[model samples]
Target: MKVLLKWLQDFVDIEDNPAQIAEKLTMVGLETEEVIYTKELFKNVVVGKILKIENHPSSDKLKICEVSVGTDTVKIVCGAPNVEENRYVVVALPGAELQGNKIEKVNIRGVESCGMLCSEKDLGLAVHSEGIILLENSYTLGKPIYEEVYKDLDDVLFVINITPNRGDCLSHLGIARELSAVFGKSLKKIISKGPKLIGQTKEFKVIIEDPNLCRRYTGKLVKNVVIKPSPDYIKVRLSLCGMRPINNIVDITNYVMLGYGQPLHAFDYDLITNNTIIVRKAKKNERMVTLDGKERVLDEKDLVIADTDRIIALAGVMGGANSEVNANTKNILIESAFFDPVSVRKTAKKLGLSSEASYRFERGVDIENTPIACEIAGNMMQNFADGQAVCGVLDTYPLPYEERIIKFRPSKCEGYLGTKLPAEEMEKRLENLKFGITKKRFEWDI
Candidate 1:
């Protein structure tokens, strides 16, 4: 699991350096497999804005442009299809080095080129066809693009090797809780309680035919949503966290999952057949094409969410393209549920579809935190996407899992550590890790 430092800050406040934290986390059970320093990848790239663009005197495909790189304006020769005047872009100045390759002044077709403009492909970011990404106008001109794009560029990414028993550490919040225990601090959670509903949600129906596969399924309908690209800040955060922003609704779900470790799915309400949701085992020859446009055949052991006509989503794995939120969608159904770990794993493996949500569900999550996470997603959708909750929730939970209780003995802990810990010290550490005490026993309600 790759863990970024910025994501870690959401749970606990650690003043230690990256190396120190990595060393500490390694010494404990969670071993750090690798440490990636992304800032060093782009050393001397800076932000620049196009001041003027003119047709090349000699070549029909080439263009002459004047770009401002903070201190002064320089004339550059370019042939990109999307070069426009007065657009902010990334500029790699002369004498600058990227990925150890030194950029130098050059002459192109009798035109003196002092610097070169960059694209996502040129910067080795990713494979893309969009003419150099038009940066936000708010970014200051001539500022180092790497620094502006990654405020915490020096942050370290720790690839943690987690064991099957350590499912709780799969999420940012879960890692935070472990860090709090190791550092003797309290972990905070960004949890919301309730949201406003503009209409009654009872207009739709929710049915769970197989309680063994789905433990609990909760859904809320939101109306009048605007589907647009996410803001720059949101896009940057998602990029840094290794996700590409899709749209407002999808981005909100990704943000909530990264923040709280709970997976959420948004479905277009109008596209749902018969305005009903059915959670049950897949039919003998059920088939669906996921959002990624890959067709998958399902077995009887697989679990799926079906409308009256066809299967709309692979439960706990991915949603179908037919019910996906689109630009014309005015209403959405936000799904937050707990699927049996065994069922999710079996289905995902059978369909050859293992997503971030399925990976977490297969391991296990804090089942009790489902409602709080749903509320967080709902609030973000309403505030960021201009969406409104339009109904009561549709919750179907036939059976709830019992909370886990662990018993700890002070002498046993000290003996296991091969050191004698004071009784007060043991109690303090356990309390700091969010364990409640009753009589001489402590329990963790996971």
Candidate 2:
């Protein structure tokens, strides 16, 4: 799991430098792959403005562009579909080096290009680059694009190799909690939005028939949501975390999932017939097309999130296309739930559909965060997506989570570790991690 240092700050005040912080994280079992300084990769790359665009006489998919490259205007050939006049983009000068590829002046299809117009892939900003990289209008034509993208001036991208057992560290908040435990720092918790949600009026019902497969299911309804691109902050966080910015409504679900270690799904409320949410095992030969546009065949063992008519989502895996949120979607149902890790893993493996949601579910999500995550996403839409969160959540947790109690003998700390530690020091670490301490005659029960 790649944790952005700035994003981690929202949960804890981590003052340590990246290397020191990385060493501490590695000591705690979350191995550090490497610390990525996103800005240091590209050399001689700067913001450029497209002065003019003309169709190439020889190639239909190509175009010739006059770009303003800070100190000078240069002619370049490009084929990006979104390339247009007066748009700012990343330009790699003749001496620029990108991904070990030495960018030099070259003639393409008879046009002598002085520089290369960059894309997300060309700049190593994203996994796949579609069109040219579009810069915001706020970016100055002469300024370096890296300075704006990595706007904290400097960001520490800690790429940690999270083991499967550490699903709790899958999110920034989870890692912050771990860091708080290791460093004995206070975990900065974000205050709940606490919006005035209307009570459940039998308008929405979430029935969990197969509680063994699904531990808990919670959902919130938000109406009049306008689907649009998320703000720059959300886009940058998601982009840096390796997610393409889709829209505000969808982005909120993704954001909170990263903030908390819980995944939330959005459904087009209008398509949910009879206004119901059903958590049950799939019927024999159940077929549905997921958001990926691929048709998947399900069986009786697969858990599903269904409405009055048909399956709306393959629970804990992906949402169905028929009930997906889109531009015309005005009302949405936000879903946050805890699925049986084994069931989710089996279903995901059968369908060959592995996603971030499935990854977390297959490990485990704190069941207590179900409704909390839903409420967070709902309130975020009201603030960022121009929507009103319909009060109350339709929560159906058939099998509640049982609280765990562990016995710890701080006096024997030296036996577990090579170093001797005092009981007060050990208790402080647990207290900082929010573990409840009950004093016993001999040891502490937490």
Candidate 3:
């Protein structure tokens, strides 16, 4: 699992650098396989503002821009189509080195270009179709762009080589809980309460026809959403966490998935045929085009999210394009529940559609976190998409699983560590991690 240091800081305040934290975490059991430092890659890039832009006297397709690097202004020849005046752009000055390349005063056509303007692609920051990044007004000119861009940007991705038995550690919260235990700190989380429905959710019928394959299926409807691109902060956070922002609706689902480790799906309410959602085995001749626009044929072993008319999503894998949220979608049905991991895994492998959501779901997310994740996504949807709260939640389950209980003796812990730990210290560590303990036994019944 890749645990970003910024995300880790949200849960615990550790007074150590990423490398030191990685080493400490390694000593405890969550082995750190690699530590990536992005700051080192961007050494001398600075924010620059385009003061003026004029057509290159020599080349029609080129533009000569006077850019301000805070201390001084310099002329640069740029060939990009989107260079404009009064925009903040990244500038690599002459003699500056970055990513093993040195920027030098060079002649382009007949002009002596002293520096080069950068695009997201050029800086290896993001993949955008635009010419150059029109940085937000917040960036101070001449400041080291990397520091401004990557501040609070210590991401120590712990490639935790977890054993198969530790399926619980597959999630961020689960990992945080474990670390809290290891470091004797507290783990806290903010869970949302699902949107208040204006009407009963039973009006929109839901059925789990294949209970064996779909262990649980919980859904909630939200209305009056304005589907637009997420805010800049939301987009950046998603990118920092290694996900591309699609739209507000899709981004909310992905954001909640990353924060809480539970996969979620949002379907356009109007596109769902007959206001029905059914969980069932796929038919032999069933075919679906997923959101990525790939046509996939289904097998009998595959579990699907279908309506009376057609399959809307590949269960626990991906949503179909036909029922996906679009710019015009106003009402949506958010799905957050558990699918049989074995079945999801088998179907994903068979269909060759293994997304991050599917990968985590197939491995097994914390069942207890389903509602919390759903709540977080719902709240984000309302806030980011201008979505309205609906009254009721549609929750269907075959059985309720109880919390896990494990016992650890104080003496046993000390013996295993081969270090002396007082009973008070051991209890404090376990309690900090949310483990409830009696004087005689240690138990976590949440």
Best-fitting candidate, measured by lDDT?
A: 2
Candidate 2 at residue 54, lDDT? 90
Q: Where does candidate 2 have its weakest 10-residue lDDT segment?
A: 192-201
- Model 2 clash pairs? 197-391, 198-391
C-alpha TM-score for every candidate? 0.87, 0.90, 0.86
Per-residue lDDT, model 2, residue 433, is 78
Candidate 3 residue-wise lDDT at 420: 97
How well is each residue in 1-446 modelled by candidate 3, as lDDT tens digits? 66666676676766567777777767767787878764544555788999998888889999999999998999999999988789888898886765467888999998989888987555544445468777766588888775685454334455666665566666666677777777666776554344332223555777888777777677777889998777655565566556777778888887777767888999999998899988999999789999989999998888999999999999889999999888789898889988899998898887777898788877787766676666667777888888885655666766666766676677777789899988888767768777677565452222
Task: Give per-residue lDDT, candidate 1, residue 374.
Answer: 72
Best-matching candidate per TM-score: 2
Local accuracy of candidate 1 as per-residue lDDT tens digits, 1-446: 76778778877998778787888888778898888876655565778889999888888988888998888898888888888888888887887765456777888888888877887556544334467667765688878776775465446677789888887777778777778877887887565345332222555778899888887887877888998766655555565567766788988888777777788899999999899999988888778999999988887888899988999999999999999888799888888888889999988887778898998899887766666677777777788889897545566667877766766666677779999888778677778778776644443232
* All candidates in order of lDDT, best leading: 2, 1, 3
Candidate 2 ranges beyond 4 A from true positions: 41-43, 51-63, 79-87, 94-104, 118-139, 149-154, 193-199
